[model samples]
Target: MPRSLRARKLENAVGLAVIVALAIASVLPLIHILYMVIVRGVEAIARIGLYRFLTEPPHPFDPQNPGGIGPALVGSLELSGLAIAVATLIALPASVLIAEFRGSRISRGTLLLALTLVEFPTILVGLTVYAVLVDHVVGGYNMLAGAVALTLVILPYMAVQASEALRGVPEGVREAAYSLGATRLKTVYALIAPAARRGILVGILIGLARAAGETAPLLFTVGGAYEGYHLCLYKVGGAVPLMIYQFIQMPYKPAQDLAWGAALVLMTIIVGVMLLARLLVKEVKIL
Candidate 1:
C-alpha cells in the first residue's frame, strides 16, 4: 500500500479509538447509577413484597414495613399521558410547518422559540401553570394544571425531535411526490410522516419519560395527595417522583426503603421508555 494511504488509515483508526473511548467514559457514570439504584432498591422491595409495594398507598414510617405507592403511580401515568397528548397536538403541527417551510422566517423563529423553551426551567413551568391555572383560570391546583405544566415543559422537545425526523426524509422523496401531482399536505401525510413515524414516537416517549420524572413541575402544580388517590383531572394529584422525594427525606428507615423502591420503579419506567426509543432509532436510520 502507498505510504499516504497507510497514514490515512492510521489516522482514521485513531479517531475511531478516541470516539469509542469517549463513549465508554460517558456511559460509565450512567451504568454506575443504574447499578446503585437497582442494588439498594431491589433489597428493599424484596423485604416489602412486590404486590404491596406496587399496589397499596404509602404507609407511615414503620420499622416492620412501609406501604405501596399506587396513587403516585397512577398520577404519574395520567399526567405524563395528558402532557404527551397535548404537546403532540401542538408540536406535530409546528414541526410539519417547519419541515414544509425550512427556509421561512416564521419557521426559523419557531425553531428558535422551541430551542428557547426547551431551556426554560421546570420550576418556571410549574410557577407559570400555578399562576395561570391554579390561581387565575381554574381557581385550584389539579391534575389538569399539572398536565398543562408538563406539556409546556416537553413541547419544545417534541417539536425539535419531530422536525429533525422530518428533515431526515430524502429531498428526492419530496420531489418524487411532487412529480406525482401530490399536494404539499398529501406529500407530508402520506410519505414524510410514515418515514418519520419512528423518530416522532421516540421523541414522544422521551418527552413522556422526562415529564413523568419531573418533581419540581409537579411540586407547584400537582401538590400530591397522601390520603387517597384522586382520579378526576380537576382534582389534586400525586406522582411517583413526589412520593420518592417525600419518602427519601424522612428520618425513618422504612420510609427510606420505600424511597429506594420508588426510585427503582421510576428508573425502570424511564429506562423502559428509553429502550423503546433505542429500538425505534435502530429500526429507522433515516437520520
Candidate 2:
C-alpha cells in the first residue's frame, strides 16, 4: 500500500534535517580551528610590530622582544621553490607519457609507483633521504637534502594530478591532432599541453603549497639553522614549518607566541595558493 501524504512529507523533512545537521557537524571543527588560530596569531603579531616580527630572527632569551622569522621565511621560499621546479620538470613529461601510453607495461609500472608513493609515509621519505643523501653525500643536514625530500613528497601528487588532467583532454582533440598527421610528441606539446594547462598549473600550485607547509621531511633533512639565513643550497637551513615544530615545544612563552605567528604565516601562504588555484579553475574553461 502507498504511504499517506502526511507521513511521506514528515519522512522527507526528517531526512533533510539530518543531512543539514551532518553538514554543519562536519564543518564545525574547521571553523573552530580557524577562530583559534586567527585570535592567537593576531595577538602574537600585535605584540611584536609587524615589520619587526617579519624581519627579525627569533630571540627567545631577550626580555624585550621575540625576534622575527626572516631566515625561516627565506628558507621556506628556497626549499619550496626548488622542490616545485624539480617536481614539475619530472611530473609533466612523465604524466604525458603515462597518459599517451596507458596500455604499456612501463607506463603501468610508473603509474603504480606514483600511486604507491602518494600514500607512503612522509616521515619515512625523510628518513630515506637522510640515509641516502644527508648521511653520506651531504655529510650533514642541508637545504639540498630538504628540497630533495620535499620534491619526493610532492612529485607523486603532481604526477597523479597531471596524468588525470592530461587524460581529461577531450578525446576529440587528440583525434583531431592525429588526423593532421602530427607525431605523438608534436601532438602532446602543441595540442594536449595547452588544453590541459589549467589542471597542470593547479596541480603544481597544490604541490608547492604542500611542500611549503611540510615539517616532517625537513626534520631529518634540513638542520633547522635558526640564527640566520643559510643562502647556499649545500648549507643547513630553517623553514617556517620546522621553526613552528621546534618553537611550540619550547618552555618559553615567547617561543610559543612565535610558533603561533609562524603557523599563521604558513597557513596564509597555503590558503592563498589554494584560492588562486580555485580562481584559475573558475576563470579558465579547461577542455
Candidate 3:
C-alpha cells in the first residue's frame, strides 16, 4: 500500500478499536446489574409465585412472611399509563407543530423550551409537583399528582425525539401530499405521522421506561402505602420503586430480598415495553 493509504487504514483501525472498547466498557456495568438482580430476585419470585406476587400486598419484614408486591405493581402501571397518555396528547402535537412550522417564532420557541425541559432534573420536577399539586392544589399527595409530575418529567424527552422523527419525514412526500390537495392537517397526521411511527414508538417507550423507573417524583407526589389495594387517582398510591427504596433501607433480610424482587419486576417492566415496541414495529412493517 502507498504510504498515505497505509496511514489512513491504520488510523481507521485505531478509531474502530477505541469505539469497540468503549462500547464494551459501557455495556459491562449494565450486564453486571442484570446479573445481580437475576441472581437475587428469581428465587423470591419462584418461592412466592408470580400470580401471588402480582395480586397480594407486601407482608411484614419477616423472612418467613409471604408478602407480595401486587399493589406496588398496580400503582407503577397506573402511574406510567397516565403519564404515557397525557404526555402523548401533548408531545405528539407539539412535535408536529415544531416540525411543520419550523420557520415560525412560536415553533422555534416551543422547540427550544422542549430541549430545555429535557435537561431539568427529576428531583426538581418532583419538588415542583409536590409544591403545586400535593401541597396546594389537591391538599395532599395523590396518584393523579404523581402521574402529572411524571408526565412533566417524561414529556420533553419524548417530544424532542418525536420532533426529530417528524423532521426526518421526507419533505418531498409532504410536498406531494400538498400537490394532491391534501390539507396541512392531513399531511401531518396521515402522511408524516405514519411515516415516523417507529421513532414515535421509541419516544413513547423511552418516556414510559423513564417514568416507571423514577422514584424521586413519586416520593414527592405519591407516598407509599402498605398492605392495601388502592388504584385511585385521588388517593395515595403504592409503587415498586417506592417499595424497593423502602425495603432496601430497612435492616431486615426479608425486606432486602423483597427489594431484589421488586427491582427485577421493575426491570422486567421496562424491558417488556421495549420488547412490545419491537413487536409493534414488526407488525407495522409487515403491514
All candidates: CA RMSD (Å): 4.3, 2.8, 4.1
Query: What overall lDDT, based on C-alpha atoms, would model 1 receive against the true structure?
Result: 0.86
**Comparing 2 and 3 on lDDT, the stronger one:** 2
lDDT per prediction? Answer: 0.86, 0.89, 0.86
Best by TM-score: 2
Model 1 per-residue lDDT at 26: 96
Per-model TM against the reference: 0.87, 0.92, 0.88
lDDT string for model 3 (1-287, tens) is 46798889999999999999999999999999999999888977777887887778887466676688888998888999999999999999999889988899989999899989998888899999899988998887799888998999999888888898899888998999999999999989999999998888988987888889999888888988857977888888878998899888988887788888889998998788778777755532210
The candidate maximizing lDDT is 2
lDDT of 1 at 238: 89
lDDT of 1 by residue, 1-287 (tens): 56798889999999999999999999999999999899989988888688878878777577775777888888888899889999999999999988889899999999999888888888999998999988897777788999999999999989988998999999988999999999988999899988989889998988988988988888888777855788788878889998888878888888888788889999999889888888888752211
**lDDT computed for candidate 2:** 0.89
Q: RMSD in Å for candidate 1, one decimal?
A: 4.3
